[model samples]
Target: MTAMSTVPWLTILGLIPLVGALFVAFVPGSAETAKRMALGFSLVTLVIGIIAATQFDVSSSAQFQLGEQHSWIPQFGVSYALGVDGIALVLILMALVLTPICLLAAWHDVPEEVGPRGGQRAKTYFALLLVLETFMVGVFAATDVFLFYVFFEAMLIPVYFLIGRFGGARRQYAAMKFLLFSLAGGLVMLVAVIALYLQGPGGTDGFLIERLTGLSIDPTTERLLFVGFFLAFAVKAPMVPFHTWLPDAATESTPATATLLVGVLDKVGTFGMIRFCLQLFPEASQWATPVVVVLAVISVIYGALLAIGQTDMMRLISYTSVSHFGFIVLGIFAFTSVGQGGSTLYMVNHGFSTAALFLFAAMLVRRHNSNSKRIGDYGGWQRVTPALAGIFLVAGLSGLALPGLSSFVSEFLVLVGSFSTQPVATVIATSGIILAALYILLMFNRVMTGPKPEELVAEGVTVDEGWRKSSGGTTVRDLTTRDKLVAAPLIAAFVVLGFLPNIALNFINPAVDKTLSYVQQAIPSLNPAGTAAEGSSK
Candidate 1:
């Protein structure tokens, strides 16, 4: 809105990493140089993200801040538009912060391998990571519907290779399944996108979200289009029936890949539900709430239960994400400011918690030389790695939403908001909190506190021979300087957000207010006094 917008903050924030990826790809130096270059670029982007966040005027009446729009394709109504509300801003910031941390976490992930053509494996890995960062930032920032879909589809390319190329043995199968599910959802969305454009004003900037915000359509048509978009998000949110691809993808991908997959990218689903499904089709959103709420509750309970039964640590963490995402979706459809705001905050909180768990778990597995993912393979680690154990415990506690942690606040807000409308479903979803405690503590007890694997095998227990042999004697190394570096920011985030949720909520609540006003859904608890006054007048 101002000449200051000439800076194109969001575009540069996304482009810096994109350009870094290209540079890394062509670097003639060793793998170490590529890694450092990638990390430095990620940090610079983070600095830009923080600057943009500071530039935002929370007091402004505008729904989006730091706006930047330029026409891209005139005839098709597509434009190089970018903007962010409070929700998108926090998500972008989360992605930015996590990128550098993930780089640090993955510093040694790739071993320099020689190819006949002389391509560096590490270069490819780091470049893919930076490319993924660009798409992640753009996906959250795009205000043009067409631009959003472009970033959404483009995201799949780097992720598929990241998993299929550098991940575990079954990586190809997992990658293909993830691609298939995502592509199927994307195709449905493509239909909806085209239908939406056809129904719009059909001009140079017709696909701008602001332009399409309140377009009138017949009930049947609106409902049909809403279904197309919602189906895509549900698969991405990965609510129950469509969520089959996640466990496979998470289990097979490297920790860094899984961190971004569940933490940042998956959020695009719930974000789309808010940005498009509810914003563009308010009536349909209200019409579909009952079913969506039911599906959300199902995701909550089902994911937790599956997590409890998992043997592999990565798969367990993945299922826990499925459960956490359910809570987020539940809050969004609840339609109260408190619920929607909580959902947004939960997205940020869960990203940090899940990333910590996955990265830390991988580090422990690698250090112990167990080369196994079975929870049964790890035992009595409290003595061997006390500092790492303690840090991992904090991450676990955050996952379960223990009181005084950041996640507890968001989870609490979500439940309170949902209870005011869909009390029964909210109550049923509350069981997930109980199940969360079971999985986290039980997993800690089994994987961190019990007898060693060799001792268990000595007592006539069945265990993997490799894990038993690899479980070294007492006094294994603890968290390293780099490990501490990777964790410090995340841990500090938990502490800050735990005690001062308003740091995020202040930015979030204003945008939530605007969204609720735009959607015009009837949420009973949102204004009980006003509703009473209206009834008296009637």
Candidate 2:
């Protein structure tokens, strides 16, 4: 069989989870069955993602790969176009990898109905998760701007429900806030998308990314259009002022939902900044860089300070992400291939590391009877749940950029690369690292290291009657076999990516080079090659 005859793997990859969502919704089955079906389908998607990655030509030109395009709306110049570069491919793979783990992590997370029949809840929950998965894959793979916007807007629907329906107390408030914030961003982007459409040469070719990139717009128009797109991305990126919605959403949602929100959905914001803002409005990007860099630095320091102040564990983690995302944005705006490539790799690493932290924290909350998320409610947990505490430490250390963790590699590259272009910002941003250590270690100490509360011990003792009969009358238990299974992949990812980040950077660097070339073309003096020249002369 010719290579062309091979399965349309990218299309299949997007479809499997979507089709699985339908099956979960319609099939007559128990909650257990729905959970299994969702996991199975997600795993299939993960396998397909692997196959697609293997098929990718990393050494090829820095253009969209494995493309599949078909005319969708001839009148609107829109088409069903999908493709991936190294950057998109890695993010897509991260999404696929995380979905199954999320399924497994949430296997017993959904509460059963107290009254008559709790028939519909599991079906609805699993179905929405699968649907979200489909959109996640589609968003990363979409090549056409209109197609990306469609996926971008559609993904929010499932997430809204995932938070509103399956979240903690104040779920409604958090869900509404999340919805409103996202809708506002989407609406702003829609206007920009329309503006872009109107400006293009009207035809079926108008909305194609390649076509849009070649447009010659006036400077004022370019900057205005850039603002439209950048505003949406900044909100989604939840930079500083726009970031207020994330803490509440994370605090209220289930760990799995929060994981996907921060890990996958938030990546879209930074991804758009790179793919759209930088690529389409190169001069405008450079024009906006001074202000954007300042915002990024504020996000870094401000987020870290806020994280240190958070009483709730989930909110604390969410704030830390704000801080981490700042580093990613800084690397992106630094305008060096090394910086861009580092930012791309940071996206992947942050997803896995954040997933581990959120999911593990969920397990701890579960052990604590699901009510108390306050750090004060959990002290000396390490004494009772050493395994869980150890895992939490590993995850937290990754967040703090410990040596030999995935985050360290990415964070290091971001600083080193950005320093070449923006030294003052990079130096200021470095202080966030110290703040990171303080927050992570302080949280660990408060929640895991202090004396065990007598009330906590009493509760654990009351719940585990069998513990008195077994060893030493220890009340609290460690992570179960299933919990270990869910955590293993995330832990492995941290280690693997930490040591062999080249596996991702090798693919990412080519795209970074191409994007930098565009930016250099726009502002010749800002060229990274100039830095190389300076180094050679020295």
Candidate 3:
């Protein structure tokens, strides 16, 4: 075994945001100061994440890097164990990168007097966002099942408050639905966790992933345990039937909040599937692949079809995520190295792409007075807000997997890889690309092009409503300096990753190979010869 690195970078990465959240909460400051402080802390965390990435040994055979372990509950075999592989590292970086962008985008989002807190609401809002960042880091970096579960469940609180308190008109309903669905999934997972503990060697080693993976469990027990974990993950992934809560939650929350919710938090589901399901119950994972793949295909077509029908811009973006997640799940369950690697990269790419779309959409709403989320509310926006339209167009193109964008590379790899294993399903899922184009272009055409609305013309263009109340006049502005600052990085990420995916794939492929190795070990019949042959032909 490689000796654990002495520097606790992962701990520092997780703690910085947490500490910042505390400081923001108790320290007295104006909303602008609070926003600046949060952005500073998040950027510092991003630097730490990049440093950790640089330090990571990409070529190592070790499954996890940057490991740190400490005893937490000796009797129950729980420990404060933290580590990341290439896959987790990428997702953690995604979370770190998006946090500051979200803060910058939301600089003026919260009203001065919201709920009972009035002037203090901004402080509370930024604090909650930072606190959520801590859980996001912890969830991805955690090596112990117990620790992961704790971070997993703890994540909902901050998001719930973000939606219920700071969101749109139906925020309370959306928050409660999100909470209930998530809690139910957690409870199901709790049962599996306890059962796995009992099935393992007794005492303090029971909850350790290294120890549990070594246990020889019966197939029946493994399958049941897999269901418990899979159910939770599927809900979190918000796949098809279990995904009803997401559209509401995404639509109701502010775009910055929605960005984090869909872009970062939801990745936890697919992440858990890879970490827990495939790693811990390899046989069960193989057994469930057939049914899961079907559901994934359904999610692709279903989500895309629904997205095309949405009039509300926020809800439309939310539906698109459901479709994209389906691709991630499809790639994972396909059990090929390329498939899994593509899925992992897709998680990172999706975060940036979705962040751009959500944040830009929010900016559009704000420019339109933040009073109307409907696509019909604005027209010929491209004529006046060309900068906004250009970025929005790039984001939309990325969402639909335009060539030379990050999403296209990942989506292409996923389809090619999955085709080697499940050709029929892969072919069916191809139609989703067409549907994606339809929804994204259709939404873009409706909101960004055509003629300017008569309302803006008749009202004399000086907007006095919503966030634009101080703007003084009816001329809709283009992307502001701050907006470009938030947008530029996301656009750069799409371009860089699109062209040089090896930057990520070099790290991701080894971890994916390790995962597929375990799957083959559990089910020797699932050898990669078939996938290899298919790839060679291509």
Candidate 4:
């Protein structure tokens, strides 16, 4: 174990945004000042994250590296432990990469309809964003189960305000829905954590995840505990029936908030399943495999169908996340190394592609204030806003798992690996690939091709006009230099990861293998080294 005092960098990294949050909260008021402070603070955290990423020893034998641990509550056996295996490390990096971009993208998105409190409103908004960043980072870095839970619950405050204060017409309703759902999930999991703590050896406090993993529980007890955790995790994963809040929340919040919520924050749910569920409750996971896979396939197909039916751009993209998350869940329960690895890879790729897509949608909506989210309202946009259109095209194609993109690799690996274990579910999920293509192509055709709508015509939503000329009147301006700066990195990430995924896969594969290793003792058929990849119809 690494000394807590020697190199507590991950703790410092987590604190950077937290300190920034406190600073922004008291910094008087001014939109310009708020923006600068927010960007500056988030950048500091990003630097910390980058250093953490670079310092990580990929070739090391340890599953989790650069650890920092200190006893917090000796009686409870809880500690302030923080570390990242390959999986959590990548997510921390992703959150870092996206945070600043979201701040920059929201620069002009928040209107002055906020009244005299507008200045304070902007400052509060930025403060919440900063706080959210800290929790997001903390959740990924936490090595202790209790620490993970703290970060998990702490994240809701900023997001609640982000939606309630800064979102669309029904922001209040959306915010409450999000709050209730999250609170319910948390309450259920709290009980399970208590049970795990009580089951500690000699009742000596065993809240440490690594220690808890070694304890054996009866199959019935395991299933009960698993359900407690899985219900909370599944709702957060927003798998199938529990996913209703997502589309509404995404559509109402600003694009930047939506990007973080859908792209990085949502990944925590899937991450938890990977880290806690499959790792801690192996036998119960095996017993529940058939049911979980069925739900996963339903999420994939149901989300795709919902996405195809949505007219709102943000809502449409939100449904796509629901669908993508389904694939991740499916891969995890498939109980193969390939499936786990693919699920991890899916997290990274989806973060990039979905961030790009949401940002693009934000750009489009900003230009045309008309709530016309319908397909017919956005014909021939490629003619005037080619850069924006092009980015959207890349995002949309990636969303559908286009070949040579980051998603294609993960989705392919997931389906192939899952076939041997859950062949029927795998086959059904493959059809989702085709369905993804359908929805994405339809989205592209509706917004990019055909005759430009009269509203867009008036808004100067032309494909050929660059931002420099301002051809679409004052209302429909082209992509600003800031917009390019924000989106370029995300787009580049998608392309780069698509071709050289080993940069990420190398990190994910080991962590995924560790997770599978923990589970295979109870589920013997899940050995990854010998699994065949042929798609089975049985």
Q: How many residue pairs clash in each candidate?
A: 0, 0, 4, 10
Give candidate 4 regions above 4 Å deviation.
Answer: 1-5, 113-118, 202-205, 454-475, 528-538
Estimate every model's Cα lDDT from 0 to 1. 0.87, 0.86, 0.88, 0.81
Candidate ranking (lDDT, best to worst) = 3, 1, 2, 4
Model 4: number of backbone collisions: 10
Tens-digit lDDT string for candidate 3 (375-467): 988778887677889999999999999999999999999998899788999999999999999999999999989886543422223332212
TM-score of each: 0.93, 0.94, 0.95, 0.93
- When sorted by TM-score, best at the front, the candidate numbers are 3, 2, 1, 4
CA shift of 423, model 2, Å? 1.0
**Model 3 misplaced stretches (Cα beyond 4 Å):** 1-3, 114-118, 454-473, 530-538
Residue-level lDDT of model 1, residues 1-538, one tens digit each, is: 2122657899999899999999888868878888999999999999989988998877888878788888899989999989888889999999999999999998877765776534488889999999999999999999999999999999999999999999999999999999999999999999999899999888999888888888888889999999999999988888897899999999999889999999999999999999999889888888899999999999999999999999999999999999999999999998877888889999999999999999888877765554679998788877566787899999999999998889999999899877878899999999999999999999989878965534322222233211234253422456667788889988998889989998998888877777776677433233423323322221
- Candidate 3: lDDT of 398? 95
RMSD of model 4 against the true structure: 3.6
Which of candidates 1 and 3 is the stronger one according to TM-score?
3
Error of 4 at 84 (Å): 0.9
As a whole number from 0 to 100, the lDDT of residue 471 in candidate 4 is: 47
Regions of candidate 1 where Cα sits further than 4 Å from its true position: 1-4, 114-119, 452-475, 521-538
> Tens digits of per-residue lDDT for model 4 on 24-112?
77867677787898899889888877886788876676667778777788777778888888999888888998999999888876655
Over 179-214, each residue of candidate 2 has an lDDT whose tens digit, in order, gives 999999899889989999888887984677777884
* Backbone clashes, candidate 3: 4
